[model samples]
Target: MRADLDIEGGVVVGIDGSDASLHALFLASEEAGRRDCLLHVVRAWTLRTAPRPPEVPPSTVPSVAEFHDWIVLRTRALVEETLPAPEDRARVRLHLPRSQAVGALLTAAETAELLVVGHRGRGSRLMLGSVAAICVRRAGCPVLVTRPHHRRAAGRRATAGG
Candidate 1:
């Protein structure tokens, strides 16, 4: 992950490979571009997804620095998918902190001008996912929770059928 030191007055957005998150990313990019600030794209993670490390001499705590390779690739791909253009994607600074989603995003928000997140994530069934809801309430900066827009098929209005 990029893991930049910190961002000041920039736009921060959290991504989780969900449609809602894609929309949030788009909105966050637009907002960041409009404000002429960096876009801090974050996808925090924990060790739960990691596989057990191999046995050592039983004299030290095992650790792996690169266990989050998939997260980095996935997050980068999502950002590229949303931003499309190479130049647009290049301007964004991606962060994948070894932390819970809310805490990571909130930490990023400490110096950010705004924080953006999806209304819900991959497995959330609520109108606003627990992560987004908590971030909205606790972020140091203004938080924007984005919901995906569903477009209806266009057709002629009902008049008469023969």
Candidate 2:
């Protein structure tokens, strides 16, 4: 499987507005920078397929293109805040998909050398916060689960002293 992964080319990462996703973005960007590879940022969004209520106006319906563009802008700003100014912004490719996250992310993973995500995510499930778990288990590529920096630092201190 490792042989198939284009580690030399780059990796793909999924991000949303959630804190977990931001953390994943940070990690993915750093790895990409270090490896001199491209960072593909993919965001998944769902649009309502059912018709709206009678009271709702046709104009109220949001354009999928607008939403996708908005997400891309917001994601770019977030990434810029976290990472050093890119020598070439073209290195980062933002993909917005109008579909379910799990499937979209899994598809993205196929081309990724690695997948990075946080330990939790924003959504309800039997596990409450288990997006990372699902991705790690389902993604075709390797996944990195990031923990809060302070927690990891504290753990290191405790281990060092004891």
Candidate 3:
């Protein structure tokens, strides 16, 4: 753990601007509140499209910055609004990055006491989203895959193997 980063009793959660992820955020916050730990919420984004030669090859991609900014803003608001009054914003930290969501989350989870994520955010239960599955399999800490409203979406095939 970085000396500047505080991970003692920290709970890291991934927020992907989806209801399921938001639920994960809420659950993480509640857990943190109970343990009096800090909650770290990270939202990740990637460039929608890479610049082509004819497109003047912009010096930098603005969309990346904008997406990260949006995630930070929205995650901060959701965290603040969902938590109880006693849970102060000072105890919550939001991170926005322009990398893969699962990788960013796993990195954050390295020093965290616990990691919380949704089972299938915006994806079918038959197939956990790549990010969620990756975190569950690779996170340094135990992962709680929350599914407060998980239901079998229509047309999802049943699998024989677990």
Question: Estimated TM-score per prediction?
Answer: 0.78, 0.71, 0.71
**Candidate 1 accuracy as TM-score:** 0.78
Error of 1 at 55 (Å): 20
lDDT for each residue of candidate 2 in 1-162, tens digit (9 for 90 to 100): 011222333667777666667767766877888878898777666664222333446778656665566666676786776555666355787766666666667777876788877666655343324567778888888988765345763475366441
For model 3, residues 56-153, the per-residue Cα lDDT tens digits are: 34685455546555556666677766564554566887766667676677788788889998777554554567778888889889898877555541
> What tens-digit string does per-residue lDDT give for candidate 1 at 14-129?
88788888888887887888888889988877777433334434566445564476677677777877788676676699887777777788788889999999999877789889
Name the lDDT value of residue 138 in candidate 1: 86
lDDT, each prediction: 0.76, 0.65, 0.68
Ranking by TM-score: 1, 3, 2
Candidate 3: 10-residue stretch with minimal lDDT: 153-162
Question: What would the C-alpha RMSD of candidate 2 be, to one decimal place?
Answer: 7.4
lDDT, model 2:
0.65
User: Which candidate would rank higher by lDDT, 2 or 3?
Assistant: 3
